[model samples]
Target: MELWYTEKHTDSVKFSIQVDRQLYSGQSEFQRIDVFDSKEFGRFLTLDGYMMLTEKDEFIYHEMMVHVPMAVHPAVKRVLIIGGGDGGAIRELVRYPTVEHIDLVEIDELVVEVCKKHLPQTACCFNDPRVHLHFEDGLRYIRHCEDEYDLIIVDSTDPFGPGEGLFTKEFYGNCYKALKADGIMVNQHESAFYADDAIAMQRAHKRIVQSFLISKVYQAHIPTYPSGHWLFGFASKKYHPTADLNGVKWNALGLKTRYYNTRLHAGCFALPNYVEEMLRDAE
Candidate 1:
């Protein structure tokens, strides 16, 4: 039997996926974790009925999540990733030679285990020595952390369950505190097509803007996610994103990438007028 992955964007519109198989589905301490193998996306990861990642386009999400901020801040040496148990984000993060350490704070251990066992391609970064796996609440971890990291990426799931607090003002304040004075943070913001989630995105925008000197939203296309479009929030204390690529090499290792390129990097920041309007009206 074929299972379908569906996210109700609205009472009138919904984004759905047709899958070949359901690999895993159950309730964790926080929410439901569902893994599905799809004909188009290869494999799909879902949390609390919301689609998170898909095989065919996972690189787009992971690459933009890691590279955009890293490119802007060439001095990034230490990094923190919150709730990216699939390791896709880490896969992209470890590509930077300047990075000395990476602390991964994920609430659910099973998400890591499942991805490792079933989705090796996505879970490959778990073996990197630079990565420190911490199976703990991300908010709590960030709260106690001082000015330690150069970059912090909130690779969380949707903002409705265990991931809800991740989008809160308190958490944004903690993220601001956890980073160095010149540090930057990138978070997985929701899509603008979903009215309720779009509203949530507005609130997140406000919170980050209040906490950081530079706050901007970038866009990308992720078909697995609701609305087939996604946004990422970048907030920094001192540095603006375009400051300098003075002596930097974009893909130093020649690490093969599918979606992210220097051209696409700049293009992602070019938001449509409608998206800008949503953000403006949000303010």
Candidate 2:
């Protein structure tokens, strides 16, 4: 017999992977967590039966999420990450010598511990001195914070289950209040290829523009994720993602990033025709 792991991307569409073995499976206070080993993607983790990250392509998502904002504002010192329990985003963040502090607020503590045990590649950076772990609801955490962080990264799951609140307009308002004057916020904007995700992408874009002076969406090709085309939300109070970006300064950092580069950072924000219409009509 062969063991396979499957997730429903839609009612009629499903994705399956041939698993070498199941490393872990248990339910936390929040959702079901599972980790598996596969020949193609290597080790991977899922929350509530949804694929969160895989070892092979994990660098793409992590690099894109952390590098884009850092490139635009190299002076960023204080940062906050909400819902990145896997630690991939933080792994990229602590690389910047300019960063002085980072607060990682994750609602589920079990996800962090489990990932630390089985997904060490992405989870290895939790011990960085700059990172202060807070096992609490991110929505509630940001709601109570004011003018605290130079950047906020919402590395959340889909818009259902534990991640639902992070996608709401009210939460975006709280995130706006949680940022400094020129703060930049990046979030997991769902893909535009599917109907459900496109609706989510547009809705998120509409709500973010209400609170941010500059709002834009960017794309990344994550082969394991649904549709293989993923999007990220970029919003700021005072900087254009490209116009104010000092690419020359960012390149000078000389980081060895597999997926994100200075040129691609600006290019990703150039939305496709259909994607542009989706965001335009979202308002």
lDDT of 2 at 7: 86
Per-residue alpha-carbon lDDT of candidate 2 for residues 1-283, written as tens digits (9 for 90 to 100): 8999998888889999999999999999899999999998999999999999999999999999999999997589999999999999999999999999999999999999999999999999899999999999999999899999999999999999999988899999999999999999999998998899899888899999999989988999999898999999999998889998898898888989999998898799988899889989986
- TM for every model, in the order presented, reads 0.94, 0.98
Check candidate 2 and list the clashing pairs: none
Quote the positional error of residue 198 for candidate 2 in Å: 1.1
Per-residue lDDT over 1-283 for candidate 1, one digit per residue giving the tens place of the 0 to 100 score:
6677777777887787787889998788877888988787798888877777787888889998988888788689999999999999998888777799999999999899888987887899888899999999998999999899999999988777888889898999999999998899999989887788799889899888878888889999987677878999989988776554322476564666788777777778889898899988766
Q: 52 in model 1: Cα distance from truth in Å?
A: 1.0
Clashing pairs in 1: none
